[model samples]
Target: MIPASSGTGLPVAVNGIEIEVIRRGAGRPLLFLHPGIGIAPEAPVLDYLAEGVEVIAPSHPGFGHSQLPATMTHIDDLAYFYLDFLETFDLREVIVVGVSFGAWIAAEVAVKSTERISRLVLADAVGVKIGDRTSRDIADIFAMTDTQFAEMAYHDPRVGQRDTTALSEAELLTMARNREATARFGWIPYMHDPKLKDRLHRVRVPTLVLWGESDRIVTPKYGRAFCDALPDARFELIELAGHFPHIEQPETFARRVLSFAGEAGVPVTAVKRASA
Candidate 1:
C-alpha cells in the first residue's frame, strides 16, 4: 500500500483491494464518491468540501490507481465494497455525497444500510429505472462521440473540453481506465439497475437530490422522479449547469451540501443563497 499523502491521495487496502483515496479536513466525516469520469487530484469540489468537512474521496476500483479485483464485476460488488470501507475505517454518521455514476453506487449502498450514513446527497445521479421499457431515461453516453457527449454533458460545452495534448501520459491513461470501468459496469443495462427503483424506499436517511438545471444526460425531470422515489428527500437544481453540477457550480454545490449537513459555521443564509 502507498503511504498517505496530505492533500493528494493514498492507496489503502480494503477487502484486499488497494483503492486510492483522497482524505483531508477535520469537522464532519464526508464520503465523496466521484462520477464516471473519475476524480482529479485537484477537483475543485473536493477542495470546497474539504474546507468544511473531512472529505474521503476514493477512486472506485478500476477507475484510477485503484486495484480492481477480478471477482468484482457488478455495481452491487461496489456497494458492498463501500460498506466494508465504512466499517474498516470506523466511520459513522458520514455525509455520503455522490455525483453521476457515483451517486448510483451511493444509492445502492444506502439501500443496504444507513447505519453509518447520516445524510445522503446524489447529484445528477443515474441508476434507477423510472420509465417504461420503450423509454430512455439516460443518454447513451457510450455511443456518443466526444463532441456530442461534451455538448450533452455540460450547459457550456466548453467547460467539458480538455486539451488532451497538454495532458501527461499518466493522466491520459487514468482517463482511459475511467471510461473502460464505466462501460464495464453500466453498458449492459444502459445505466439503470432494474431493481434499484423498488429498493429506494429502503433509504431511511434524509436525502438531497441535486440536479443540473440543464442536464441533457439525465434531465431534471428524471432527477425529480428519483427524488420522489425516496421517502425522505428534497430536490434542488443548480442553475447554468449540465450533467456535472459539482464541476460547473462548485461553490453553490458545496454551499448547499454544507447547509444540508448543518456544518457548524455555515450560515443559515447559505440555504437561501443555494436556492437563489
Candidate 2:
C-alpha cells in the first residue's frame, strides 16, 4: 500500500521505490542524506543550509514514508539507488552531505562514481573498521537502553529526547520501521563494510569529515582515520556536541558545511573553533 506523505515532504518514485524527499530553498543543489534514525523534515540544519543553497533531504527507502522493495537490503543497495537518483534528476556538480549511517551511504556512492557530485561532507560516520577484529570501533546501539543511547549520542541528552506519549501512532510506527531498516542494512557486518575501507581511495573529490567533540558512538580519533583514508579530506570537530552535531549545533554545522561547499550566501569562516 502507498503511504501518505510525511507532511513536510513529497514522495517520488526512484527505481520503483517511493522515496520521501524534503526540498527547500534554491541555488546550488545539495543532497542531504540522513542518519540511521531517519530524518525529521523540520530539522533546523536543513533550514540553515537552505538559506544559502537548495537542500534536498531524502528519507532512505524503508524509512519514514518511503517504500522498501524486497530486493533492497544492504548499504550498497542504497549507494546505487542514490547514483540512480542523481542520474534521474540530471543533477550535476552537486554537493552531497550525510550524517552517521547516511555518511556511509554517501561514501559508498562517492567511491563508485563522482560524476554528478562536486564536494562531499560526512559527519560522525561509521562504516569502516579501523581496529583489530576483537576491538569495538562503534558503540553497540542495539544493546543500549534509550537513556544510555541518549547519554552516549548527545552532549545534552535533553536535545535528543522524544516524548513517546506525545507522538502519534504514525510517528511511533515510522520510528520502529527506521530502526528495523537500520538493522537490516548494518546488522550482519556490525556496521562496517569489509571492502569499503579499501575503496576509500576511489572517492577523489575534496571531502570534509565533521565529528562531535563529545561523541561516544565513534570518537574523533576514528573520524580522523576515516578522513585519512580518503585522497583529499579534512577533519573538524563540533564543540559541545555528540554523535549528532547537526542537532546539537545547527548554526555551526551549517556554517562549516556552507563554507566548505563554498556557498557565498552564508558568510562564515570555516576553522576549528570552540563553543561554535
Candidate 3:
C-alpha cells in the first residue's frame, strides 16, 4: 500500500475494481488523469498543480499501484469507470485535466457522464484518430533507445533520464506489466477513437488544448485538430518542450494550466510564484 501524501487516500470500486485515489489541496476539484507507461499523477508535473487547487489523481485500474482486473480490455472501460468515480465522489462542476492517455479518458468521461464538467485541459492528449498521420505505436516506442525515446516523447531532452539498470527484478517486472496493460487499452488503430473528433462538438464545456511544440510523437498537427473539433476550445503550444512539456517545463506548464483553470472558474491563487 503506497502511503497517502498530501491528498487523503480513498478506495472506490469501479466495475468491481477498487481504484485508489489521492485527494489534495482545497477548493474546486480538478481531476488529473495521467498518461500510460511509467507516468503517474504523482510525477512532478502534476505535483505542481496540487499547490493551487484541490487535486484528485486516481491511478487507472491497471497502472501505478492500482489493481488490474483479470479481464479488463479497451480504453472505453476506463472512461466509464471514471464517470462512475466522479458520481461516487459526488463531484460536480469539475475541471478535468488529462495528459496523454489520461486525456483520452477525460474526453470519454466528458462525453459519457451525466454530470457537468466546467472545463477541460487536454495536454499532449490522444483520443481522436486522424487520417494519413501515423501515431507512435506502443511496440515501436518500446524498442527505442533511451535517447530516442526522449526525442520522441519529449521536445526537451532533459526529461528523458532513465537509469533502470539498477532496478530490482520485481520493479522491472511491474514496469513490464504496466506497459502491457497500457497497450491493451491504447493499441487500437490510429491510437485514438475514429469517431471521437466528430463527437467533440457534443462537449459543452470550455476546453483548452495544450501541446508541446516539439512533440514529434503525436505531432502538433494533431493538437490543432483536437482544438478545431471542440466547440469552445483553443490551442496553445509550449515552446522548447516535447510530448511531456508539463515535466520538461514545469513552471511554464503550471502557469498556463493555472491560467486555464482560473478562466474555467476553479478558484485558486493568482499566478504561480516563480522559484527563487
Candidate 4:
C-alpha cells in the first residue's frame, strides 16, 4: 500500500493503478508533470502558476508516496497514463509543464498525442539522443552521491544540502522510494528515448524548450537540439540556474513559463514562495 503521505493528491485510478493527484487554484486546467523527486504542490512554482491557471500536480507512480504498480516500469507507460488522465478529466486545450525527468515524460506524452495539450513546456528535459555518439549524453543521477547530484542539479548546492539527522524515518523512506522509481524507469535507456527525437516532429502544439543555462545533467546544447527537432518549438535559457531552474529561481522560471503558457499577466509575486 502507498503510505498515507501520498494523500497530498486526491487518489484517482488510471491504467489499473491508483495515481495521487492534487489540484490548486481555479481556472483552465494546467497539468504539471513534476521531476522524479516527486510532486509537492506547496512548491512556489506551482503556486505561482496556480494563481492564474488551475494546476494539476500528480506524483508519478513509484515516486513520492504514490502507489507503484508492478505493470508500470517504462517512461512510455507514464506517457500513456497521463494521456488517460487528460481524457478522464475531460481537460482540453491544456497547458503541460514538466521539469527534468518530468520534462521527459511530458515530451513522451506530447509526441504520442497533443490532442489535449495546447501549450507544452519542457524545462531542462532529458530523453533524446543528440550530438556525437562519443559525447556524454546525460549525467547519471544514480552514480552521483547525494551531495554531488545536488551540486550538479542546482546552481546553489546548499539548496539541496540535507541535515540527515533531522529527517524522520518516513522522510528517509520517501527519498529512497523516489530514487528507486527513477532508476526503474530511467536507468536502462540512460535517459533518452532513441525514437523520441523523430516523433517530436509530429507534435503540432506550441512548445517551449526551456533550459537552465548551467544545467550539468543535460546541457543547454542538447536542449537546443531537442527544440530544433520539434516543428513548432523555441528554446529559451534561464540564467544562474542549473538543472532545476524552477527551484533555484522560481520567479524567473514562473515568468517564462507563464508567458509561454499565455498567462504572462499573472503577478508572480502574489503567489506564495516555495521550492521544487
Best by lDDT: 1
Question: Which residues of candidate 2, in runs, are more than 4 Å off?
Answer: 1-7, 263-276
TM-score of 1: 0.93
Candidate 1 yields a Cα-based lDDT of 0.88
lDDT by residue (135-251, candidate 3, tens digit) is 342225656787888778876676676678988886687677778877788665535776666666566677789998888777788788777777667899999888777778877
How much is the lDDT of residue 139 in candidate 2? 96
What is the full ranking by TM-score, best candidate first? 1, 2, 4, 3
Q: What TM-score would you give candidate 4 relative to the actual structure?
A: 0.90
Instruction: Give the Å shift of residue 166 in candidate 3.
Output: 1.6
Q: Estimate each model's TM-score.
A: 0.93, 0.92, 0.85, 0.90
| Tens-digit lDDT track of model 2 for 52-76 | 9988888999889899999998899
Q: Model 4: residues >4 Å from true position, as ranges? A: 1-7, 263-276
Q: Model 4, range 63-103, lDDT digits (tens) per residue? A: 87678778888999889988988887688988999998999
Q: Specify the highest-TM-score model's number.
A: 1
RMSD in Å for model 4: 7.5
Cα lDDT, model 4, residue 167: 93
